[model samples]
Target: MFKSLWLQTAYSRDPYPALDQDVTCDICIIGGGLAGIANAYYLAKEGKDVILVEKDTILAGATGNSTGKLTAQHDFVYAKLLKQFGLDQAKLYYGVNEQAIEFARSFAKEGEIKAADSILYSQTKHGTELLRHEMRAYETLGIPGELGKNSELPIHIDATLTMPNESQIHPVRFGQHLAQLAVEAGARIYEHSDVVLMDLKKRLLAMKSGHEIQFTELILCTHYPIEALRGLQVMKLAVDRSYIVAAEGNMPLQGQYISVDSPKRSIRTAQFDDKTFFLLSGESHTAGAESNTEVHYKRLNTDVQELYHLDTLTNRWSAQDPQTPDLIPYAGIISSSMPYVYLSTGNRKWGLSNSLANARIISDLIVGRDNNASQLYAPDRTGFGSFLLQALKISGLVVTEFTGGHLTRTNAPICTHMGCRTRWNEGDETWDCPCHGSRFRKDGSVLEGPATKPLNLK
Candidate 1:
C-alpha cells in the first residue's frame, strides 16, 4: 500500500549527480525542491550557468510531501491581502498566482508535469462569504472565474469555486523532470551535498564536506536560509505545518478542494493502475505546535471515512511551508544590504504556484530586469498589521515554551529552526516535538515522522 501510494506513485525518480570536485557557476541555488529546480530551469534557459545543490534528493523536502493542489485560491487569502496591503498590492499577488496556474497547464502540455483533477470549495459559511469577496476582487482586477454551487461529490458544500484549467501533479516527478532539463540545458545538480556556510565577502559557498564553490551570485533557496546573514528571514517569516493522508478509494473523488476555517481540510484525488486514491489534507498549525499529530491523522481518516465512505488509509505525510505576515511570498534581491545574494520563500502552502512565479521574479532580478512581481514579493516590503499579529504569535510561543508544562527536560534540548524551545518528544526522541510538531534527536535525527529530514544543523 505504501509502495502504491508513495513508492510507485508518480514523483519518485532521482536526478543526476553534482560536481565531484569544486566547481563554479553563474548562480548556485542551495535547495533542489520546487523553487530551486524551477529557478535553475529558467536561469539555464536564459543561458546562465547554474548549479543546484541538495542536501538530500530532489523534492525530498516539503515539495515531495505536498498535497499537490495547483490553484491560486489560497483559502480566503485575497480578502486579507487586500485589507492588509492595498488593493494594488493584492492584485499583484493575485496576478502572479494566476500566472502560476497558466504555467502549470503549459508545463503539463509540454510533458514536464502532468495534470490531476482539481475542485475548489467553500466548506464554511465564512468561506462562502469570502468566495463572494474573492470574486469581486477578481472581477475588479479583470480576471475570469466561475462560481460553483454543486460539487461532483455526493457531499454537500456551502459553495464552490472552480478554475477549470487549474491542475495537480506529482510534485516529485515534476521536480525531477525540471532537474534533468536544467542539467541538459547546462545547469548542474548535486545531491547529498549540504552547504554549511556562505562567505559573502569571498563570493563562495562552504560545504560541510569541506568543499567550496565560487559563484558570481547566490540564491538562498534552502527551506530556510542556513547561514544567518543580514536579512532577518527568521523574524520576518513563520513556519506552518499541515498534514495529508493518501487513502485508497472505491470510487474517484471529482476534484481538489480546500477549507477556509481553522484546522483546514483539503481534498483531491489521483488514479494509479486503475485504483483511485484520495489525498486529504489540512489541520494547519504553527510547526511543532501540536502535541499529538497522530490524533490529527486519525481525525482526518475519520472525516474521510464519514464523508466518502472510504476505508483504509494508505500513506500519510506532512509539509512545512514558510508563512510571511503579509500574505505574500518573498522573491527578489535578498535585501539592499546584500548585493549578490537573492532568496525566494514565504510560500505558505501555495508553493506549487508561488514557486514558479518566484522563478520568473528571481530570474528577472538576477539579470537586471524590472519585474513588478519581484517588487511585490520583495522580502523588505513591510508595514502591515499582520506583522504585529505574527510577532504576537511568535512571542506567545516563546513565552509558552519557557513556562508551559508541555516542555519536559531532555538530555538534548530541542531547537526549532525558528528558535522556539522543543519539548521532550517522548514517543520519538530526537528531542521531544511541538511548535511545528517535528521531532529531532539530541544530534538531530528525525524519529517520529512528518518531517522529511532531520534538522539542518549545517
Candidate 2:
C-alpha cells in the first residue's frame, strides 16, 4: 500500500481533543473532510454552537488524496447533463460550482496558493466531438470556456477545453486552515470520534468510546454515508477508486488536465515546501472489482514514463469516490424520514467544488435563508425511470456479492456493512467491497465506511 503524498508531506498540526464527555449542540457535523469542515466554518461563523467530529483526522479522507483542482469543469459532464436534463438544469450545475470557486477564494488570504486555467483534453475523435458539445454547454451556462486543439501536456491531444482562472490548493493546508478558522470562530472540533450508531428516538449519536452526542440537527458528510437511514437503501451509488502517483520532478503541468476518454488520466503539479512533484492520478475501477489492483499502479507508472520520461516516482495512494447515477451529488434533506436532517455524498470525484456547493446549500437551509441551489441537488430524486434502472443494476451487484460471501471458500473477509464478499486490493493492500464500497485495512479494521463495525477476522 502506498501513502498519499499530501498526507505524508503537505501540512501538519496538533491533533484536536476527542469527545470525552456527553455534550449537546445545536448541530453536529460528521466527517472531517472539506464538506464537513466547510459546513462547520459557515455554521460556526454564524455563532451557532456547532460541534464537528472525525473518525480519524481532518483531510484524512478523499480530500487528502484529492487532486485539489477547484474547477467547475468535471470532465465533459455538462454536455451529458444538457442532453438528459434541460439547459436550465445543466446551467444550474455550472452556476453552483462557480459559486463554490468564489467561496473558496474568500479564504485565499490565508492559504490559497495557485490559480490557473483548467484544461480537459481528449485523445480520440469522438472525445473531441464531446468537447465541442461541452463548449456549447459552457456557452449556455455563461461559463467562460473555449474548445481548442492545443495543450500544455506532453502527450498529443485532438482537442482541449479550458476553464480559465480555476484554482488548486494544498488540501491538507487548506483543510487545517479552515478548521483553525472554525475553531477560532467558536466551533468545537473532536478527532478520533468514531460514531458507531445513532439513537433516533433520543436524537443522539453514540460513539464507539461509550459517549453520546445529542443534537437537534445532524449533517452526515462521511464519504459513503455510513449514517445510512431509512431512505438510503434505495439510493444507487457507484463507488469508484482512483490511483495517484506523486513522482519526483519531471515534466510538470502549469495547469490541470484530464482526459475525456475512458480509463481517464488527470495531470497536475504541486509544490510542497522547496520541492515540486508531478501528480498523475487515474486508472479508476469499481471498488473490489479489479482483477488485480497492482496493475492499475503499474499502468500509471508506465504512462508516466511514456509521457514525461520521469523515472523517479516518489509516492502513491488511492481514494474512493461515491458517485451518483446521474453524476450530481445528493446534498440536502436526505429523505422524508428525516426532513430536517441534512447530508452530502456521491460527489463523482468532483468533491472539492461539490463539497463547497453542498456546504452552502446546507448552511442556507439551516439558517432559513432563500436558497436557489437546494432544489437541483435534492437527495430524494428517485422518480425517474432511468434512475430506477440504475438502482436495479446496483441492487443486483449487491445480491451477487452477498451470495459470493456464503459460497466462497477463501479466507478473505466479508464486508461488515452488508456481508458481501471482499476482493483484495494489491495496490492499497486493503479489502474493498464490490457491493457497497466499504473498505477495510489489512487487519480488518474499517478504513472508509457505510460499515460502522470491523470485520470478524476470527
For this target, which candidate reaches the highest lDDT against the unseen true structure?
2
What lDDT score belongs to each candidate, Candidate 1 first?
Answer: 0.70, 0.84
Model 1 alpha-carbon drift over 4 Å, by segment: 1-15, 109-120, 399-407, 416-421, 424-443, 446-458
Error (Å) of candidate 2 at residue 38 is: 0.5
lDDT of 1 by residue, 325-437 (tens): 77788887877878678888879888988898998899888888778877788876666554787756755665676555334543334454444456543222235344434
Clashing residue pairs found in predicted model 2: none
Residue runs of model 2 more than 4 Å from their true location after superposition: 109-111
Error of model 1, residue 59, in angstroms: 0.4
| TM-score of candidate 2 to 2 decimals | 0.96
Best by TM-score: 2
- Model 2 Cα displacement at 22 (Å)? 0.5
